[model samples]
Target: MKLYIKYMVSLRCKMLVKEELTKLGLGYASLNLGMVETMGEITHEKRVQLKNNLLKSGLELLDDKKSILIEKIKNVVVEMIHHTDEIPKINYSGYLSEKLGYDYTYLSNTFSEVKGITIQHYIIKHKIERVKELLLYDELNLTEIAYKLHYSSSAHLSNQFKKVTGLTPSYFKKLKEKRTQNLENL
Candidate 1:
């Protein structure tokens, strides 16, 4: 039996959930962003207990099918973009379809309906966020960040970053530097 959860997005959240489940003596086979596969069927009382426990942590146990599916989609994208060390080389539609075991068209339509944005645009947004993080880290140069994120070139990365953030990558870095300097002086 799988329990779908809402707002269980981060690793910290997942760990907290796992702790709750263990406390209740619920054995789970797997736990992903929005879904938990239990090792065995849960009794009604146990389910209710789990629900309440999740609620206490600001996570909701999902019952609605559409909401569950939407959460799965978001988690998959988030994991792929933010969690993975290497950006996938496969086409995203193909990757999502394969990972979710649904047709690309269905996933796309469902995601668009629920999120009010195309999957491609969502992906671009995440890529920009990752670029910002990398720029802030100050470890990798623009070209390397572009290549690591699998952008065709730095120019393309810069263009998309500017489009999403309304600031050039260099300017963003400079702003961070200025803030740090001000903090140090204080």
Candidate 2:
């Protein structure tokens, strides 16, 4: 049996889900972002228990079709952006459609209706967050970060970063450095 979870976007969330599954004595074959495949079918009582346990950690077990579909879309996007080593070169809507086996229009409309943000905007916001994370890591230069995130150029990445964050990427990195120095001094 496959279970879908909501608000499960990070590795921490995945670990929590795994812990809950083990605690509940449910054998899971595998876990993915916002999803798990159980070794066998889960009893309704255990399902309810798992749902309640997950809720304590701010994760929701999704039984509703619309909620499950939205979670699937979010999981796919999050996996592509934050977890993958290299993002695919194709356009995201087409990629989402292919991955989910749904019409792009349908997915877009559902996401906007539920999230109050267009899917493209959602993608942009997540990309910017990932950029922030990479900047904080101090490992990749801006040009390489742009390339890794599939931006056409560093200039394009800077433009979007500034547009979304109201700060340039260099300034953002500088802010991180200044804050780290302050923390070290303290």
Top candidate when judged by lDDT against the true structure: 2
Q: Total clashing residue pairs per candidate?
A: 0, 0
The digit string of per-residue lDDT tens for model 1 on 1-186 reads 999998898989999999999999999999988889999999999999999999998999988887888888888888888889876789888889988899999988998998899989988998888888989999999999999888899999999999899999999999999999999999
Best by TM-score: 2
The per-residue C-alpha lDDT of model 2 at residue 29 equals 90
Error of 1 at 31 (Å): 2.1
lDDT of 2 at 167: 100
> Which regions of candidate 1 deviate over 4 angstroms?
none
All candidates: TM-score = 0.93, 0.95
Model 2: clashing residue pairs?
none
Question: What TM-score would candidate 2 get against the native?
Answer: 0.95
**Candidate 2: segments with Cα more than 4 A from true spot:** none
